[model samples]
Target: MAKHHLDPQYLDPNYEPVVNRSGNTPFGDILAARMQRRTIMKGSVGAALAGLMGAGLAGCGSDDDDDRASSSGVASTELGFKAVPVSTENRVVVPEGYSAVAFLPWGTPITGAYPEYRPDGTNSGEDQEQQVGMHHDGMHFFPIDLKAGGNSSSEGLLVMNHEYINQNALHATGPSYVNGLRPADEVRKEIAAHGVSVVHIKRDSAGVWDLVHGSPFNRRITGNTEMDIRGPLRGYHKLVTKFSPDATETRGTLNNCSMGPTPWGTYLAAEENWHGYFANKGASQPREQVRHGVGSESRYDWELADSGADAYVRFDITPGSGSAADDYRNEANTYGFMVEIDPFNPQSKPQKRTALGRFGHEGVIFAPVREGEPVVCYSGDDSRFEYIYKFVSSQPYYAATAGGYLLDEGTLYVARFNDDGSGDWLSLDLEDPDFAAKVQAAMGTTVGDIVFEGFENQADVLLNTRLAADIAGATPMDRPEWGAIDPNTGEVYFTLTNNSQRTEDQVNAANPVANNQTGHIIRWQEAGNDHAATGFQWDIFVFAGTQGTETVVDGEAVVTLDDDNIFNSPDGLWFDYNGRLWIQTDGSDDAPYQNNMMLAANPETREIKRFFVGPTGCEVTGVVSTPDVRTLFVNIQHPAGNWPDASDPRPRDATVIVTRDDGGIIGA
Candidate 1:
């Protein structure tokens, strides 16, 4: 069989080809520097081990049934349930003591007369506007009574991103085209399924989880919803589209992947892979568009709608006989941002926090907030050889008055991992004297292939974020995906999903394997445990591969998975309040693990075990648990065969609610 390394999250096989030619030190060298061969375990991590393992292999614990202990003499992670075996069956599987039930499948109504879902995909565009969307990704559960100072687990608002759509499963007979033009209504339905959904859900007295129909807080933020633009690039010239001449607004958020919940209780929907939705058929595209891969063809072909309406025409970014404000040439620029939504307020408009910078944002993870310190958050661009970033708010966070505006003013920084297990966060703001000095000093020098011509302004730096990172000498990673912060350790963990295109010479410590078919997780500790810290120590966490398989470079020691804990493409990541790191995968089923799955890891002992396995042809992504940790919610996207309902031919993406049969704390 051929090696499958490209992430399954890519919409097209050719999408996001290796764009980073920066020749930065690969992560493999970094790991090799920190590694010291000790004992040659047959098929386990011999030398290259978890960062927490240290030089003596202290914290690396065994998850075996009879050996639930580590060399450090500390107890293994308090995972209460037995690890379930991997499965290719078309069904959701949980531990023997847990129950997995499907809830709120796509098209279940919650607003505007509660339009019922039609399995045959006959729902009209208007009907879809009031219904749930397709391909659920990142999600969060906000207690309904949160404002009242109560954490109500029984009732809460479940807000999640509808990443993208499956055209075959959406339309009755699939999409139709005549003379290369699509029906306007079909295009409208597709648009309606691309943003975020806020639904009110409740666990009744009978312990059944269901959606609350007609709840005031239940509403859909679709592709046509009018949103406010906020932060540094708010009225920038590049955002001046025909729909928003003042550049203070934009319609819709697309390709929203994983999300981030702010310390102030607002939900942040990260826009990822949004570049594929727009087609720039112009002679020459700007650096911003070219750097992010906005080419001549769109993924859905929505721009070729026969009706030629303003909304439909905007998808085609080809220059017209007019300026940026007169034509739709700048439409794509309005996307690729972090959109903040207040789930508590149904009337509040979602705001695009442009100060966070623009790129393929896989997700955002905020650090533990302090009463009078700047709010800091981290995000990663999910493309081959892209960079990871963090934003620090200029204003100190005050719980009493804090809200989404805290994200309006911030300094964005890109990371640079060094071979010595040390890394630095480079400031992307040109206004910073230090950053300005570096840009001025390197003006004539060529770093990556592009000349260091210093940015026009702070707004220009953000508009061309990827290009700015390239010029700033940030370390290009192997497809940085979902991120999670250890609630107990203050360490940040990011999934460096597979990058098959990485050549032998590109192998480095953070990403040690060339032709990286199965990816690994890399983590770092901020200086003084401060999220805003500029320097830090780093290490490789775990390398994803088959049991006993040696994923090595020149015989350098990398981790090997055992039977109980093996996975690929570690994508979605979350740390429950108790510090149990939930790791989800989004890779081809053929890679050792026959199906996409979720695993629970004890960051302390470095012990991991599979927790849940999704159906065939599906990616197990988003994850969140109720306050008491009794109920866990995991999303299964793009499942194949009959799922949730064996009799139903049309499989729908849905959230799986896992609860203990005895109603104990989940994952213990």
Candidate 2:
């Protein structure tokens, strides 16, 4: 609910993720300017609406009938989004009759006491690890009782990613003025709060979803939680850290963002913008940027301002007086991978599967696994013109398969777009002398200077993976973000979120556009539509734009955006069990569109419609649906942007459960 009003000078009056975080704007001037713009905007948008063709709205409910259409190989109804207004005062809104409940939220008990969250900010580091976290993102519910060995109880296992902290929103009343520092203890607690939480969920007879407190399945993996790494890169001497004596076990997972669920029912949580956590000294120098992902703009700038203490120093990633044999500059190399965690098994240590090529991993979507063929996963890097990646496990998959073990053993390949419509998956193996040379060359100075000051070991190369990608020549994309796989067709779809950083001249065959502010969603059909195929052909499925908006057109509107389903900044993506594609927007486009929203599309028809929109200034992201197609789970993240009044930041971060009031299937 707490959100900053859009500023006109720093940002265009369109739906967009770009915000002027410069904090230089005078609030008084902004209010005055906004008043003038509002009058002008209302007229322009009103006139624009008059010329546009109206798309009829379909009231929200089940999409079960869509399955029948797919079964007959017929294109079902085109999907569109209709605002589901469950609440008027900055809250989760759904269609009429459909209802929701908070599955889990910050400070909620896991195995600890069920303490009601207090606005006074009375949480502690030790308590944080066992409690729920802020900004819930990607999540999935595993019906243990449905599968052959799935849990038999009516209760289910919920695996959700806890993204970065909302320091302002946490503990109400904002910052506790302990001196000037944002209490290092608060920072420490935050680090421990961001990761994966596996909780037992149950739908009571009333159809309301609730956390099963004290359930044996409840557990939290924090930034400081112990874990191990496995793959060709495992224990390659690049992962060693002060804490990881074996170079395999890692201290924790940070900035846990979107997630992927495995064919074997395991959870895959991604680490996004992780490079910012390590404050590598001398970043102002251009040379430092080459070695690490951290540049000038990082969310975790705390490392820059904070004194090295309470483990904060470890994040400095600066050359230390202590031996590489002494400090943690080299330890950062362990993060930014698709960490696999088994929700059902409490004793299982989370595993970072290096086989999945890493970057700013948004999420990985699993294709139907075919026996004797590699199991494929789709990944996106949430960076401007970064890259979209895929990993095909060298091992074949079995039907009705789940993959914790096979995930550990596989080839992680980055994608390369060709001059033609075809593409190739580049292997990240050290076998390529060119790649090895380039990476080793870049590593020379970093090892000698900062990351591993005393001991820049091979581990530095692995953790500073974006640098490694550069050496490997991985293809950069147009702000690759979230991804989804077509269940009926097996084709993969990914969102290239808007990237203004790129110029028109830099555009090439893959990118093909300069300053592509309105992004596109791309899809590819693997050779033979086989998951293991190395060669694949791709096409721009749809250029997401409001109807009448000029966008990349692929002849057909395979994935077009329009008023019926008008949305922007395709970020969170998921295919429900029933095969309807759910698209959540981040960094929504300019004005007339008040807030970013969620949309549902029938892929066969390429028709999209707005399903729901969040309260003011919120991104509608993080979605996962139930297998029965009955319940749709979505995460409302950072509802309150940088609002000055933390106490009143109206839309608190939370996860929502959406189910049809008619008891029909979802996406129908």
Best by lDDT: 1
lDDT of 2 by residue, 436-493 (tens): 5655565534432234222143344334444445445555665678888776667788
lDDT of 1: 0.82
Top model number, TM-score: 1
Regions of model 2 farther than 4 Å from truth:
1-89, 146-154, 171-173, 176-182, 282-292, 295-310, 398-403, 432-474, 504-515, 550-562, 641-651
Model 1 over residues 1-668: C-alpha lDDT tens digits?
Answer: 11023233343423565666666655555555665444445543333443332431212223352343322232334676799998989999899889999888888887998888888889989888998898999999998888877888889999999998877778897778888789999999999988889999999988898988778999999989999999988899988999999999999999999999998788999999898789888898876777777878787888889999998899999988988888889898899999999998899999999999999999899999999999999999998888999999999998899988889998999998886667899999887777777778777776554655667788888988887787777887878999998765678899998888877876554345567767888888887778899997777677787786443323444445688888888899998855688999988788569999999987755678899999988889899987767789999998877677877768889999999888777787
Measured on C-alpha atoms, candidate 2 has an lDDT of 0.61
In candidate 1, position 102 carries an lDDT of 89
Model 2 alpha-carbon miss at residue 483, Å: 1.3
